[model samples]
Target: MAELKNRQWLLAARPAGMIKESDYRWNETAVPPLKDGEVLLRNLAFSFDPTQRGWMSMDTYVPAIPLGAVMRAGAVSQVVESKKSGFAPGDLIQGMAGWEDYTVTDGRGMLGLQKLPPGTDPLLALSLLGITGLTAYFGVLDIGLPATGETFVVSGAAGATGSVAGMLAK
Candidate 1:
């Protein structure tokens, strides 16, 4: 087979106040061969979230994206090669991936690799069917716990999470 190049956007520098195009640098490298227990993925879609800013600027739930490293983001991807059990080529999965054309994972990151159900919408898997939807579902049901007839108010009702939360509350 032909060689595959991995295109990436690396974190060039940390932002002082606001993030800019200068904060990232473009990169391309040969796709590495998969190791045992690792799976190769071709990124199909990425999820842009407000928390990624915090990830770029400082350590929050996760450490900051280091300078010269691939910028971190959530993505829906298709498995291209697998040395791992339970995953095979052509299977669609979602998890924490980087801003790159290809990714290699051992299925043990923060979100871990999850096989998307057949015919699942990739875009929705990144949003309403992924973390955003889960956050909204649990936040409202577990934390908020509004009873019948109680008015549920979502603060950021216009955002992905808020919009889903509002719908769940209805």
Candidate 2:
């Protein structure tokens, strides 16, 4: 609908350890229109956590985010407009829409707004119920192979996944 003039944070100089704000840069750029089978999403929210910190480190851990590249962050967005099948405008969803106002989603990983739980609490579904929930459903329990009533400990105890895992452990 509106022109895609968006701004975002990008990894600038690679960091040695615990990523600093200076390691990233704020940028303004124009997003292109979505082509056939593509939907343009207006980003609503994004997640910043430990892995992103790893990405900011040396290339051995993960590729560096070249100085001018837009920083990689997992995000959710609402469809402002769409030409793709299975997606309509105004749908709320979660996925990798990056950190920008408008993103051209190629019908890739777009979640229909109707499928989200009927509630207004963004944090519940966005961070907790969405990716974090999916991870909790599959990660800790799946990977750890906990038996019934096994004592499970979540490593990143302060984060979304750990919080959910801790609850599920009880």
Candidate 3:
């Protein structure tokens, strides 16, 4: 319970053009003991991308963040405390945990009870093999439906997914 008193960064203001670190604020919150089906997790690492800025925009994603809450960021974390079934300490997970040293979540929207793939570095997944890979894989071959050896024109051509899509198209 004393640990919950530690601080975190909440979304101080929704970004206007970009998410300068100024658009966020530090939150000192209590790390309460878990009630049924809740878990306390220690923040590890997270992924950041351009679409996250879009999520800040009222036009693109869900409602904009109200000032003074944890800024929107995805995270990989470890369970330090749990009151849920089928989960325990030391379990690694991924989800939108925000910018905090610790977080308490009701085990939802999380994936990964299994270890990350061998040598498939999660950071690489953050780039080449993660969301970027999915974006590239679906964009060219799925939605756009390129024929064999057809030339593909791409915007953001040097970006994470576009580069992969261009290479894949060749």
Candidate 4:
């Protein structure tokens, strides 16, 4: 517990237009001991998407992440320790673990602390095959519904969702 360091990026202030490093504060704290029904996650990779801006604003699908708190972001992590029945050590999980080296959860009130299939690539799971991929999939198939040969335009063309949607559309 005391040996483990939980490095985190905390939101220092809201962005005026574009985000900068000064907008966040980085620090490390000891990883607390896991309680019953909780699991300790060692984050491997983080997902950066356009939705992060919305999260910085006053409101969106979810409440804005409070100042001085860990910046909110999805991550692909491994269960380093667990006291929960549904999880075990070495299990790969995807969830909203924020911008931190480690997180602790009870598998509750999270995006979905889903376990990745054995041997699943963490990079793939965190990017094109993750939320961005799902947003593109639904946007193009459900919302756009373009027929063959129809031209579709993407707004944030270079972003995760836009890039993925473009590829899927093509």
Candidate 5:
């Protein structure tokens, strides 16, 4: 196969309310050579969540992605090359790989590199079994703490977390 180029969507500016495509600047960068203990991942899909907007804000659980930085995102990707022990070519994994089509990692803290079982569905990995669902599960069960027969209120009832929260509430 031909050499793979890395394509990325960078945060161009902070938005006031909702985000638009113009808020991002697309650019291609050279994929760097692998270093010892590093693995190259080819991103397959990204999760669009409300927290992404929060990340665009001035403050969040993590520092906001800086302007000109690749927009922060969680992705499902396949290992394309590996210098790491547990990760090998063709292994599917989940992590915070950002908006780039490719990412390189040495499996450090919070990068949260997790290898999926063979034949595991990427859709499931990106959804019900992913952060979105886990967030909903915790937010509803732990944080919300609604008792049986208690009414549950979800503000963004149409969103991924909200929908899961709603169902878990019911």
Candidate 6:
């Protein structure tokens, strides 16, 4: 149909004490053509987490977000164009889409792009069914390994991951 303009928030500078609006710069650019094994996605939802601070400031499990690059964040997106197998137009997917209206990927990153089952809620897919849920699932089932009827204590039970961990423990 019409041409697409990709809106983006690029990392301008690393934070000093706390993050500020000036740390990022807004930009809009033309969506690039897809190459083989790549898929173009329109972001629908974004996941904001405390770990993103680390990603912006220092090198952690993943490298820090480079200046002049899109600020990193996980997102739920819909495929707009695909040169990759198993992904097609209109498919809903989740992965590291950063702070952008559009993203192009080859299903590779910290969490590779994954297709959402039909009718899945985008918000739920990015939250409880995404990294937060996966972290709770692994912690409670794999690491804690609490037996039935055993008391499971979850700190920060009001937070995202902890709340899910508490629920999964039940």
Using TM-score as the measure, which candidate wins?
1
Q: How accurate is candidate 6 locally (lDDT)?
A: 0.91
**TM-scores, all models, native as reference:** 0.96, 0.79, 0.79, 0.91, 0.88, 0.94
> What do the candidate models score in CA lDDT, each in turn?
0.93, 0.69, 0.69, 0.87, 0.86, 0.91
Shift in Å, residue 119, candidate 1: 1.6
Model 3 Cα shift for residue 106 (angstroms): 2.0
Q: Per-residue lDDT for 49 in model 3?
A: 70
What is the per-residue lDDT of model 1 for residues 1-170, given as tens digits with 9 covering 90 to 100?
47899999999999888899999999999998889999999999999999999999899988888999999888999999999999999999999999999998899968999999998899999999988999999999999998899999999999999999999998
Candidate 3 lDDT, 36-123, residue by residue in tens: 9888888777778777676555545455556666765666677888887766787765566667788788856433333344454556
Clash-forming residue pairs, model 4: none
Q: TM-score of the candidate numbered 6?
A: 0.94
Error of 4 at 124 (Å): 0.5
Question: How do the residues 55-150 of candidate 5 rate in per-residue lDDT, one tens digit apiece?
Answer: 886776778889999987778999999999988899999888879988988877454898888888897888888987898899998999999888
True-structure RMSD, every candidate: 1.0, 3.4, 2.9, 1.7, 2.0, 1.4
lDDT of 4: 0.87
Q: What does candidate 6's lDDT look like per residue over 67-136, in tens digits?
A: 9999988899999999999998999998998799989888887989989998889899878999999999
Model 2, 78-166: lDDT tens digits are 77888888778777766665667777767443343332444555556666777677787677667866778667778876888888877
Give the winner by lDDT: 5 or 6: 6
Cα displacement (angstroms), candidate 3, residue 115, comes to 6.6
User: lDDT of model 3 at residue 34?
Assistant: 76
lDDT agreement of model 2 with the native? 0.69
- How well does candidate 5 score on lDDT at residue 13? 86
What residue pairs clash in candidate 5, if any at all?
Answer: none
Q: Candidate 5: what lDDT? A: 0.86
How many residue pairs in model 5 have overlapping backbones? 0
Give the candidate number with the greatest lDDT.
Answer: 1
Clashing pairs in 6: none
